[model samples]
Target chain A: MLPNRSRTSVLVFLLPPLLLYCAAVLFPILQSLFLSFFSWNGISDMEFVGLDNYVRMLTADDIFWRSFFNALLYLAICLVLQLGGALVVASLLTSLRRGRELIKTLYLLPAVISTVAIAFLFVRIYSIDPVGLLNQLLHWIGLGTFERAWLSDVNTVLAAVSAPEAGGSPGCTCSSSTPR
Target chain B: MKKLFRAAAVAAAAALALSACGGVGAASDPANVSPTGEIKPREISWLLSRPADGAVINIMKKLADDYAKDHPGFALNLITTPDRPSYIQKLETLAAANKLPELFDTDATPFAQQLAKQGKMVDAEKLLKSLDVYDDYRPGALDYQRFDDGSLYMIPFQFELEFIWYNKALLEKAGVTVPKSLDDLPAMCTALRSAGITPIAIDGQDQWPLERYVAYQPFRAAGPEFVQKLKKGEATFTDPAGQKTVKWMAELGKAKCFQDGFSAQGYSDAQNQFTSGQAAMYNIGTWELPSLATDKLNSEVRDDIDFFTLPTTDGSVTSANEFVSPSGIGMAVNSKTYDPLVSDFLKFALAKYPAEYAATGALSPTTTVQTTVPANATPLYKKALETADTLGAKQAMPWDTQLDPTTNGRLQQELVLLVQGNITPEQFTSTMDNTIKQNAPKFFK
Candidate 1:
């Protein structure tokens, strides 16, 4: 769309950044792909064992399948709850004119908190001995018998760890779907 | 339009400059000093990976202050990443970028061995020999940090072992004696529960403690050599010894020996429960010695805390004398950053570490450093040292450390399943054997 001289100028300007990006990100990703074929402990000699890592991961590794299925379950929950809940909240916000900013800020708090901080906060909230906030709430509600180690129980652990992650970016999702 | 172009050009130039300064070739210029030995201040960065409560950082800060008083040319800049997994990630990232600090604390991971192979880490053994402190280390302290080929890469900070701390008063109240063998544990737990006390407090959420429990019965049944054989695929986890070990562990779980909701319990949670006298026993490493010595614990039980090793199983080849003694985190120096001043600082730090450690009722890996037990030292600390003396070189390597990383992860997960009674001992061992077999070729020849 530009004149020949302008196009040349634009290309010159873009070349430096393009080369820099390739050096920083793309090259390392490509290198990792190459390294994946070899059996290397980083300290020892790299032995070429083409496709063995993949073969093992796909076949004999039961944990890999467990983790894969676990991840899919998390994704499904996030899609249904996080994105869907954000849409509902965004609709409610759009109907409100008064205290809009305050409610929005409160809704966005979890989304804005650092991942490390959220992890630590959730860890404390799930602690069993001192009784975490969740367990304490259950006790207050006269449902104390239902309170068990949320993070440790095989039935609850996957859901416990996933809950925070699902709640983390709700505000971002809400804003993205909000009508201008 | 012209102003926008100028700003863009400036931004690109700045980015390029930053990138240039980041690579391996860009070592910061050394500070110049005057003839009168008036030195320009230069900060030697140290990346520490340790728990803040361990008082290691406090002691290091004190040492740095003392060093500064003399040199007046140096300042120490410490950056701590306290969590182990994140700390290892940061170290690996820095090493990959060739931007490691002048000094850094690290575990004896495969990455550290790789760094040694690449000649990027200082030869700690050679440095110790030069300082005439080569003979100072306790027997076998340095051996644990060596690579498969016997090359030393890390300087051991503290010698550690896993042990059980029991409340003597609680045991007495329950009319249960200290358990001398694995068989005695179930009865002890039942007696404690009958006396209205929680039995064993374990950190099941972290899962490593559970893994240790699984490893112990096997360690007793088959001896330490079995682990090496298992790693090589020569021996399977489904071997009778290993299966029996898993079955016993599952039985303990079914018996409710551990505290209620233990599967969700954390290390600190378990510790607090035991120290507060809510539980009869706590299992932890020697690193927790300082915490045990602290007055923060329940006064009623603090004075009554004592420890004992897990007793051997029936038909066990190894005795209770053999224990899980792994080397704690070690400090490594950047080979590229080595200078006379750095070497002097290290010599001073290593010399003072043992003495400072003793004040907190903890012992450094060095045997040569003389210490008078501090007035505030707990009796449990004395018991820890006595236990350490009996361990010697026959230390059981942790399953996580000995097995390949991928296999180790699955092993921990399966261990949790076993403890949860979600999987049979046979199922757990079969899964472990399959995973170990697949990865053994990578780790073993």
Candidate 2:
């Protein structure tokens, strides 16, 4: 099943893909790395200012740091809810005997919807006047006073945006065929 | 032998894939131009930011339909994005790929300026001059979209001016008259609040309105040059003009002049609040005219709506006649257009757009489009038409359009935080000043 061949054969076979990958992905990344050292508006000529961009981002850009922390928080939530929660749900579904397929399909609806549609849906769900669905649910449960503008409030905006990703978690039901 | 042959084929396939990247068609070609110098019959893709059901979209559709009836072969394929940010992103991505549509629109920002600088956008000044309608546009209408070198690249469409719209009945119920000056607004707000009505329903989530609200005092005190000077690092927010504006804005926030949880309220939500009679006043631009005058939801309160120009602030140099007037979204052509018909269609569409837009009760940026409010029109529509004649020469550009992209974005979020009481007024001004200073050398220079 094997042909007698030298090491040169293997090297020749590997070279094309390696070159293509470097040109398409690695080259742009390297270019960005080089450009990061300059102060440029993307259109104008570059002014070399080594490490100043990094320094400005770290020291002066509060929003950048806030976004960075928010991203980390999102990752933590996603790992917990998406991965851990999915495991729990998949196990529970495996134990079910009736209408398991229908429930799985219903839960998977959000994952099928476009992200933009999901975002607009959440915007409606977070509206303050006429009462958004979330607030309405809270009001129905005698927690009317607790209702606040989820998206407008700085305290709640992160949570509001994060809810869509969490809702998109289908709880690993599709992986039910996988053996332990 | 089979394994060796398959490996060889895989390597050959990889080389083919890499080579195909170069074989792709160029976004633009000079060869598309005919030897006769006449525009070839072709369809031009137009990327529009307007909603599918928006007033402007309807007007554009009507014009396109009329143009199609007249021109047999030429056509415009209008593509739209759901929202502004996504629309801008789509344009930017297309630009990166050198696949920009024949015509599109964008905000006045460093991104648009960059496109002009790179010669990716047509010289709008030249095009309008060729069409002999350059002078017909409202004076200072195109000022917002000019580059540092003073080359314009976008053709402005709708002209917008900002003011406060209050329910006449609600104001009367609170025993308050129209405020003659900014100093009177606090008292009016207080009286309305005591009457158990929200004083103002501002779209705080939009951030542009909040920025304009903060700029009112500085713009009045320092005149139009203040913002331009600030952008160039010649002025700081620590100046009296800047401090005065920020202090007044914070005071309004502290007084709870805006509707409860207004910071979280969206544009449509705030508009609904005012129209539904839950709020006394709604502050927005002239673009809201159609909704204010004729929306089905405003049927009950339609008779009660009227506007007052932004009131005079303390130390104001300009009179109350002056307001924030700037060109709305403007169309720009792709400099690397493959089809000459693209330019031809733009020239044809622009000449007819004014009259068509006016028929829909919308204001056209062109001075020639005569506005005639129907005799039986609602009082709100009539009032807007009357105010059009009184638009002062000292029109201030919206803050977002004037400031560089990085500084403008930071200022938008920071202003929202300031109104939320999370930061002091001083902090807000300082942040904006510092952001402008940092970005000046890169953007302004």
Candidate 3:
């Protein structure tokens, strides 16, 4: 029903917002890309160098590379935990009818708590000695062989840190439960 | 015609948004000096890495108020956070946006050094000399805030000396005395366990405490020379002494000496347990004095808190060096600050800052301030001070503070792994080298 002139006016109106967005968000991002090339600290006059930060990070900084791999490992766990947990929980929930709300609520309990609280709770569960609830229960059930300090060591630190999201209790045993 | 009107409205909105990013107000103006050629009545915000409830914050606030009263043109905007990791992230985010507080506190951690290396903080040396009280701080504390090439960046608050805290009651019950050195610790642990009480209560989940434990052993075995060697790359943690410390950590786990969830307890929680007589011994630093003094323990339990220097490891009177971080929290000014006002502020902040600071927390970091400990500050803190006086150096940049960020990050993660038995002791050392090599080859070389 509008005339061609009206449509052109609409385009004109939209142009400002598009321009502003480009200036505010996109512009800074592009600026960072340019700045990353130079070794200048924030205050000094910036001189143009080429891809030095990136190159140094990759080739010269061993710890950076080590942490990056550690981060990648963490990311993989997150993906698996989020999707795998949802799928498994959904399938298990299908088997319940009565008290479905209660069970569902309990399943979602962790989702409602602060991450710090959850981290602490799991630490008690996977303590290194037979003192932890997990070890105590394992002993009671005659599965004491599986006990260890969940957070202290490097091998199981990642698993312990991510276990909460994986539908497992948190904390590493000998158990240095790490990653979280 | 309607479309044209819409376009005009959108343009107006865009213009408004663009302007919003500027001039939050004259309140935040970098200009607008007072009659003294300094900024008039400006409030400088400080971002800090300590909890608001922390003893340091309470003292800093009182001091800021006192300073403000003396200088009407200045005020402090104090922002504090308890979470260390998040605090660093927030600082980084603020940096990216070019918005930082006027002052703040950070540890000798690597990220702080990054801020200096990346040119975020003002050069502290200029301000330090201007303040005139620079030499009055415990000599090494100030140096800890500087970079190796001698660039001053931050103001240190205290000299932290790590050591062992023993429960006199529990040890007495086991008829065991505080170990004169590390060699006696294993025997003490065995005796305490046989007496039906744990020998130590370690907050193991906090990885840095464990790092302090491992790093100290090298110093114990080879004397302070090991610290120099470790810093210079001549020594690796795989050395027999370093392994001894690692094995000690493992043995503690095996001995079942820690509480049910020591790994999960936060820093305060673990210390509180030891103060309450739940654990016989705790290895920690000096900042715990205020908490230990005021803990909700009976006189008997409270009386039991005492300290011993980490014991000798090798035969030659080998005293394990305490993990002493150079100075405490540092103070820095915004570079955009007017020089005179900044200088005046520094002079005032340093002149009486330490005495008042220690008075607030029972920690007298000032050689000038004779801090009176409450009736109950375990004689250990006083004894620890004497030991600190004789430490190798007051100002060497701490390892945790000196390492580049990438290397530091790898160390934190791999350390968690090494202790978990994820890798053998040799592999632990090799992994450290490999990880750093992979991430930052130039710095190591």
Complex DockQ per candidate: 0.25, 0.22, 0.15
- Which residue runs does candidate 1 get wrong by more than 4 Å? A1-25, A92-105, A124-146, A175-180, B1-47, B52-55, B58-79, B93-130, B146-152, B172-175, B190-196, B260-264, B315-321, B332-349, B386-393
lDDT of 3 by residue, A1-180 (tens): 556658668768877897787668765665566567875433233556798788878987666787898888887897677665566666566666677666665665566677778777887687654377877887889988876656654567687887675554211120121111
lDDT of 1 by residue, B69-163 (tens): 88886888888888766787788778756788889986555556657656777777787776677788876678667655666667777777788
Residue A119 lDDT in candidate 2:
81
Candidate 3 lDDT tens digits, B182-253 = 557667777888887767766655556655555555555565455444544565566665566566655544
lDDT winner, 1 or 3: 1
How many residue pairs in model 3 have overlapping backbones? 48
lDDT of each: 0.75, 0.75, 0.61
Q: Which stretches of candidate 2 lie over 4 Å from their true place?
A: A1-31, A87-118, A124-127, A133-145, A173-180, B1-41, B53-73, B93-102, B114-123, B140-151, B295-297, B334-347, B372-376
Clash count in backbone of candidate 2: 0
RMSD of each: 6.5, 5.7, 8.2
